[model samples]
Target: MIEIKNLCHSLGGKLILNDINLTLPEGSIMGLVGINGAGKTTLLRLISGVYSADEGEIFCDGLPIGDEKARERLFFLPDDPYFTGHTTGKALFELYRVFYPDIDRKVFLEYMSEFKLDEKKPIRNFSKGMRRQLYIALALSVKPKYLLLDEAFDGLDPLARLSFKRAINQAAEEYGTTVIISSHSLRELEDFCDSYALIDKMTIASSGDIAERVNRYCKFQLAFFEDFSEQIFFGLPVISLEKTGRFARIVLEGKEDDMKKALEKLSPAIVEQMPMDFEEMFIREVEGRGYKV
Candidate 1:
């Protein structure tokens, strides 16, 4: 497990993150979500030891995050990973092998083939998406206990995104790799992440199981033959409500069964429940905290 306690950071005399605490377990994929410039990448960099914390500390397993042994068990892939000019994919692999002596050349070759990349070709000539794929393959070959990826799905088509997700899952299941991926795509994160952390106000505002958080509030669409006042649902734990004539869509905070039973008491002509996904939950959460998206 990774433990962060009272972590703080600053750059150019401006505070980026403050008093942040987090616990990430082994073998689970976590999604880091936030608005642009919310310090999501900065937090990831701190955990990876690229930027030292100005206060508190980070522990990987049991060692301090900056320790060589602790660092050896993790790999950090930045938003823009570096590759020298005219560097071939094979040369990249060789360079990585220096840091990760156990780098699996066979697995690397297999991934290159699967992604239809030529190892002999210079990475400078590769497209943005192609370079992303190559780096992902290298990360897998390193087989670290923990993996950190920033903007992991930036330059890819739908097919490539699917492939990347599959590869990440495979790594977690097969090698117990603990992965933390930062992305703006909530839909993509919802597809695979077991949990999420939301960054706001220069700190980790919230974090929890993805399913439980999204399911806490139930949404419903209601249509009544007779008119009804919007005040009817005021007594209930309504998060948000919108109405059009006799048709009203409401989001209430409660379990599905209980909320449905409560809405049924109103005896509406039509009552249909709508599923709330991660994106909606995120928007509501941040808005509740007075952060405009």
Candidate 2:
């Protein structure tokens, strides 16, 4: 497991992250979601030991992250990966092997073949998507204990994204790789992540199993028999509500059975369960945080 306790950091007098605390266990895929300047990248950098934690302790499997050996078990792929001007994909693998002595050359070659990425061309000439693929290949080849990826799904089409996510799941199941990926795509994140953590205002706003958090709220649509005061439904246990003519769509903060019982008492003409997607929940959570969602 990885533990980040009271993590804090700043750059040039600007607070990039503050008092961030998180616990990530092994053998799980976590989605790190946040807005552009919410410090998702900064938190990943701190956990990977690229940027030192200004205040707090970072531990990996009971080993202090300050030790070089502990850091060796972690791999971080930034938004824009750095490589030598003329370095080829094959050469990149060799360079990585110098640091990650147990690099899986076979796996690297297999990924290259799967992605159809050329290994002899200069990295400088590779397209943005191609470079992203190469970085993914390298990250998997190293087989680190913990993997951190920033904007991992950028520069990829739908087919490629599907293939990438499938490969990640395969690797996690087969090799027990603890992976944390940061992405703006909620739909994509929802597909692969079993757990999640949200960052807002330099602090962790929420974190937990994705399914559990989503289960806490229920959505319903009701068409009243006649014109009635909309305030009748207010504060019954609602996260938010929208009204259209006689129909009202609401998100209730409780279980399906209890909510159903309560709504039955209202005796609406048409009552049905409404769909609640993750984006809507995210908006509500952020709004409660006093921000414009």
**Best of the candidates, lDDT:** 1
TM-score, candidate 1, is: 0.96
List candidate 2 segments past 4 Å from native: none
TM-score for all models, in order of appearance: 0.96, 0.94
Supply candidate 1's per-residue lDDT for 149: 93
Compared with the true structure, the alpha-carbon lDDT of candidate 2 equals 0.87
Whole-structure CA lDDT of model 1: 0.92
lDDT of each: 0.92, 0.87
lDDT of 1 by residue, 8-79 (tens): 899899999989999999988999999899999999899999999999999999999989999999998888
Clashes of each: 0, 0
Q: Stretches of candidate 1 above 4 Å error?
A: 226-228
